[model samples]
Target chain A: MLKIENVTVKSEDKVILENFHLEIQPGEIHALMGQNGAGKSTIAKVLLRDSHYDVQGMISFHNKDLLAMNTTDVAREGMFLVMQNPIEIAGVSNAELLRTALNDRGKNTGNILEFHRELTEYCKRLELPTSFVHRDVNFNMSGGEKKKNELLHLWMLKPNFLILDEIDSGLDVDSLKLVARSLVEYYEAYHPSILVITHQKTLLDILKPQFVHVLKDKHIIKSGDFSLAEQIFQDGFGASTMRNGETNE
Target chain B: MNRIIVEQEEVFLQDESVFFTEIPNSLVLHVKGNVCLALTSIHHMEVYLEKGSHFLLEAFVFMKNQTSKIVFHNEDDVVLDFHLSCLYEGENTLEVNSLVDKERVRNYIRVRSVERFGSLLIKATGEILENTRDAFYLEDIQSLTTHQERVKIIPNLLVSSNEAICNHNATITHVREEELFYLRGLGIEEEKATQLIKDGFLKSILQIEEIKK
Candidate 1:
């Protein structure tokens, strides 16, 4: 469970998120839909404790104050963010990197043979080739392959809270389905809380989010069940505008 | 320290023979005749492998003191494999020159190879120093043999190579920025990411058997 209260974040003398508030419960998928520049990615970056912005407010994870923790500490506390664009490290192989990551979190006990066997099985289920384990992370990979690699990290780390920032943007139809299905399976198995920020609704069709919150003008305008997402899709954000005069022109 | 003088037009070749053996400080080797010398130096000394006759020379210099030089002259059908390394805290220099008669009858030579028709020149220099200067040179005349000559140079200097070879190449690149960002996003710190890159680079170089032992 995570909570953000009256979060005000500014970057480069420009206000990104002002007085934002959101609560995510355990074992729930929250779909955050917003137009471009609605500070959707900003929220994810703040949750990841990125130092690029000057933030003022309180962010808590499982009742522990999150704003005070560094990036590694945040990760060790079971938070993982899959970026919009995955990075490509040239010579660092995926298995080696994953092993280091796992070891850093005290999840690896130095059983390399067992680790390889488990990683191979995980890759097989994710429809990835075994050779990908030896290849450098995301280097020279196609757009679809990059997306799949992100999912591979998710499966490997198994963090408590997952934030996916526009993960389905450049993915093709097949890759989108693969990524969405993996998230659904992960939720069913591990039941980790997820915050999915996207503009498209096709991915939500696979995950079937528990709640949909429409973000506008650096704040949530509406919160409703899964039908709210369908309604916004059939109509538009203007169709579900609240009676409150908080709507921006 | 005692010294051994090698005269010209002489061949010093024996099975398991050590020239400049146990010499402490200075070694003067004067060459004039056709000479073949296979010498190994255990202490730091100045060595001259000069050539006047058709010669074959193989010298291995290990753990030198102040400085060491391997100077040679015109010879035919000559094979040279020079392995020079320094472990002391002093300066060292290795100068090598192979002069061949380009206009005379074509002679065949190989440095670090076997069964090659043309002439071959091989120079191997390895140094492990705290504060010292180590140098390697290979000079030759053009148009002597029909075969192509190949030169392979492997230099590993931990500190600096100031005013050394103009072809000095130093590869000390940091990790990719994108990789650092990706790792940070995954909850790994920037320091850990950089250490991983350094470890990977050193591991690749350590894979060489000659360098590992």
Candidate 2:
């Protein structure tokens, strides 16, 4: 459903990703595991067409070039990226944000009352308080609350391709379980292609990724199965990437 | 001049009622309600209140080519809450007088406070054009009381005025370059970043009033 071919991304006169190529079929959960400054997040940003990077090569979703589309257009084409640090826009309520997203997809507008009712139910399942809907988007919320709020947007919008950027970080045990279960349920229901990026292996254990890619030195050094994540957890990427050597052909 | 005096101990409660008056002299009114008072050429108006008399006074003044003034006087141990807004686009000269002569004189002009449990909002908006010199004088005297006043005056003045409070403070500033760069680093464009700042400012004002209402 998504393809990236020989893409190189540079930011601030430094190479972040070089010749990175990957493809994900529909209903596949691809987990990207790498250490700090390993260009994992940079890959996500590049795919989102972030202007900070001077990008080269092709990134297409359903055969449509992603680099040519604006952020709103990319969003309209069923691509959603949950940021690592979600921005808090003070006066814009969560409900209004969801309404805009739903309306942008040309969904049913007359079912707003039903939509709000369903949102409350979803928030309750996610252990978010009922007042979360009325509060401003992620404004003054706790870390766990912000993660849950992002999950709330995921449940409401239900985009085609979901990019989870280190969403497991800084979450409590209960929140992590809730977020994991929510993703599992969402994948089971809609089966949207998912990309879970993380340095930790705990969430990967729960989500059970199909493919694992190791990003290092501005490129993907190794691509393997979910067992590769456990091997990295046990032996660490330092020895694995050293054995694999600088480049993967 | 028909003068209706509100006695010191009188309590007026009129709900959903309309009052029409052509009174030229000062009308000492102590009214409490969901009421509307339509007055023409009202001069020297004084409204006094007693203790625990919940009142709402809405004075609509229509001064056509005449000098008109409305004065408000608050009594001791009384809560005089007023919301006064005028649309002065005529050639007539109009002046508003607000006086707080007692303790606990809380004035909430243009914006309301969510922290305070019980507060008063005195909001006014006026637009004057075509050689109209309008004066809005707010004299707030407080002793052991708190007053919060916010005023917004939007006038497209063709001619300058020295007699009125014509201190026009106009400012045009672009978004900070650092803020723009920060947003751009997050993949937001320069145009979208500028729009976000403008929308944030406008949305904050509207949100405050929405909470007040």
Candidate 3:
């Protein structure tokens, strides 16, 4: 469903991603494991067309040139990137933002009442208060709440390709389970392709990504199955790099 | 204090009472005791407060091409609060002057608006006499405009007393960048996101539910 080839990313004078490449099929879940400053988040930003960095080479979505599209166009074409730190905007309510997004998707505009009813229901499952619908988006919310709020958008938007960046960070054990359950449900219902960048074994265990790739120094250096994630957790990123297969480590 | 709803173009308040005026012009009020006044779509006004009195003005402007001036005098142990919300097209000028003469006097004012093809000028001045003790004055003004809207605000605080506390702030701009990014990240087009931001900015002033009823 997604392909990246010879993609080089750079920010001003520094090289962030050097000739990076990856591939994902329909309904496949991929886990990207790396330590801090390993350029894991950069890939998400690059795919979303973040204007801060410069990208080259080809990224194809459904055999279409994805790199040429703007951020909104990419999003409208069924790609969603859940940000690591969801920004807070004062005065803009969560319900309003969600409503605009659902309407822009063009598929959910038939029934206004049903849209709100479903959104409120999703908020309840995420343990969000009903008042959250009227509250400003991400304003004064705790880290866990912000993550759940991002997930709320993910469910409401229902993009075909999902990119989750550090979604498990700052989540307590209970919220982690709830989020994992939400992801599993989304996968079962929509069968969308998923790519998760994370360090937590508990979250990986829940979603159970089909393939795991280790990212280091701005490129993917190793590729393996779910056990690679377990090894990375136990032996650390540096040690697990030596035991990986399907790549020249 | 009696509660009365104003239904005329001109209103005069000489006694202690709560006045609710909708769309009035030329108001002259003198409060000897305590008064709570709500003015909606008022065009012109002058207000004066006597010693040991309290006054609150909730003024909303939804008219085009209006000019207004309001002056308040505070004697000993007097308090005044002014809240304003304006949304309309064309040019508007609102001037406010407040004077505090003796001890334990306080005044506060705040104005907010969102407009299109609108020009607004707001000038607010506060003066505390040297003989006054423990006087306080504060004013906060903010305007968010879109599509060829113009706004200029000047808040002046003149204090001759050492024990007086005075401050003022004025901010005028369109939807901010980070705010736009936060909305556009959700797949909303730029124009629609800007409209949403504009709507949220003016929601507090519009009072949609109250108007719907």
- Winning model by TM-score: 3
* TM-score between predicted and true chain B, model 3: 0.79
Candidate with the greatest DockQ versus the true structure: 3
Task: List per-prediction Cα lDDT, in the order shown.
Answer: 0.62, 0.61, 0.80
Per-residue lDDT tens digits of candidate 1, residues A62-125? Answer: 8899999877788878889888888776557889889888878878538888888888887887
Highest-lDDT candidate: 3
Can you write out model 3's per-residue Cα lDDT over A201-243, one digit (the tens) per residue? 9889999999999888678888899988888888887677753
DockQ of each: 0.28, 0.10, 0.46
Off by over 4 Å in 2: A243-249, B1-213
Clash pairs for candidate 2: none
Error of 1 at B191 (Å): 3.1
Model 3 residue B189 CA deviation in Å: 1.4
Residue B174 lDDT (model 2): 36
How is the predicted docking of candidate 2 categorized under the CAPRI scheme? incorrect
